[model samples]
Target: MSPHPQEALSTPRAAGLAGILFGLLLGTAIVLVRLAVPEHPASAGAWLTDSSRRSAVQAALDLVPFAGISFLWFLAAVRDRMGEREDRFFATVFIGSGLVFVAVLLCAAAAAGGMLATAGGANQQLWGFGHSFAYTLLTEYSMRMAAVFAFCTSTIARRLRVLPRSLVWFGWLVGLALIGGAGNVSWLELAFPVWALVVGGYVLGAGSGRTASG
Candidate 1:
């Protein structure tokens, strides 16, 4: 007899491949952004004003493609494993947070643009406010991004039951990491790409077709 059509889509092997690819792409982009940052001047405001600053911003923005693609792949994987009908909540968790992610990035771009327009190589409240607003929005979505993934992962794990309990708890840790980005430790933002990568491996390597709840 043939395997169930759904079975093929939900197989551990397929999810594993997708997750690895997602991790590789996301991790690569994070590395690219981190490397690009050092090339930029220390002041966010100063960097925003210079032509060189624009280059750095462009380079950073380029990673959006990788991030966006990883997010899409994750969504597809979710649909395959969980079924579209039953997993609408997790679906929203992933997609809604993604929409917010894009919004925050756009806000960041706008904030930088505002700074570029106003800075006279000195203090400008307009530009500073814009950048601050952008960062605030970025922090908000960044936190939400971590949380949404945490919930989505748990929901999937609960259904699939392939992952060990300890690994599942790590997903919650990823969510907490985002909270630090909101405070003085903004550099901690680097953690997510790695977290996503590991989670990608876990989801693919460890998951059963039907999570425990399912």
Candidate 2:
């Protein structure tokens, strides 16, 4: 079934807003988490025990859910705008990878939250495990999923000409960086948010003028 005319008309604007919110929230959360947890741990216990570090992690975790929600809205709005032009195969991959990314991100936050919950107990081993698990989820699994999402979205956008050629190329670069560098390089995952920001800003600037080509 097709969306109502009014809803269809509003989707691009909503998507732009959602994407901007998602990018900002996700980028801030990543920065906070990086500040809280060192890429190379000097001492595993310190991250969990330090008051400021713990606070930063908690703040990051708090922002993640909102980011995830905004991302979902962004996805929905984009799909709605695509309407009859969307390719089902790519759409499925795009949506699936996006949802997986969010789920893994939430799990990562939960792992960090668990560390905080157990902080007073002085369980260094558990804290270490949770910290490692959270980082793995964020860098390895979640980011890889994000890479897939980026690739699929870029491909679809390019085919539909909904996004500019340069932006589509940039999206491919961001996806490759996320896939290849996220797990190895500290702060490399920031590429995802950077890409999102560019895309979002473009969408907002383009406004209702841009529509998916049939």
Candidate 3:
């Protein structure tokens, strides 16, 4: 058997990887659309021509795979604690996050539609700004802040028995720091890439091992 007992323990890294991939591709889509949009280098509508919009849509589709893979990964990790303490709190965070994600997605789709409808209009450039702003807000709400809360809670529940309380408490504090953007531009966002890297490394280290359902 593989060394790790819980799939949830392996989840953070997986979830992190999914978030990174989504960020990379979605980030690229935004950049490309911005470049192509008319009347603005910064506007997403510029690059989002019919063809580019299709590309952006595809990029958006990519998020499903990214999130799905991580979701399963985290699911495995959290399986052990499914009904334990703090599990319900994480559920609350997930629910809030889903709401935020849906709202942001609606905003993005609307903004994309506006850009397409007003391609030739001069005053409609606001659509691009709307997309970017909504993107930022929703992403922060869904992935960054919510993620920190979820991660800290999961780790605390995991470490409550053996790990030092100081370590567990520090993790919770770091998670809070990540959510509040304590040091700079969202420590959560910054930590995501690192978190992904760690997961990828761990999965790699567990070379030839398989993820089995218990």
Per-residue lDDT tens digits for candidate 1, residues 1-214, read 9767556546554656655665565456445444433322335544444566466556555555665565666656655666534466666776677566645655555564455456556455554565566555544565566556665675567566646767667766766667544434545555565665676676665554444324
TM-score-based ranking: 2, 1, 3
Task: Give every collision pair in model 1.
Answer: 158-212, 159-210, 159-211, 159-212, 160-211
lDDT of each residue in 135-194, candidate 2, tens digit only: 899999999999999999999999999999999999999898888888898898888877
Cα misplacement distance, residue 90 of candidate 2 (Å) = 0.9
lDDT of each residue in 1-214, candidate 3, tens digit only: 6545555345434544444554454444445443444333364443554675555655554454444345435434433334354445656664454345445544544555554555446344566565555445534554454455445443645544423455355445546655677224522343433443333344333322434423
Point to the candidate with the largest TM-score: 2
Using TM-score as the measure, name the better of candidate 2 and candidate 3.
Answer: 2
Worst-scoring 10-residue span by lDDT in model 3 = 205-214
Give the distance in Å from residue 188's predicted Cα in candidate 2 to where it truly belongs: 0.8
Clashes of each: 5, 0, 13
Count residue pairs with overlapping backbones in model 3: 13
Q: After superposition, how far is residue 204 of candidate 1 from its true place, in Å?
A: 5.3
Q: RMSD of each candidate?
A: 5.7, 3.1, 6.9
Ranking by lDDT: 2, 1, 3
TM-score of each: 0.66, 0.91, 0.48
lDDT of 2: 0.85
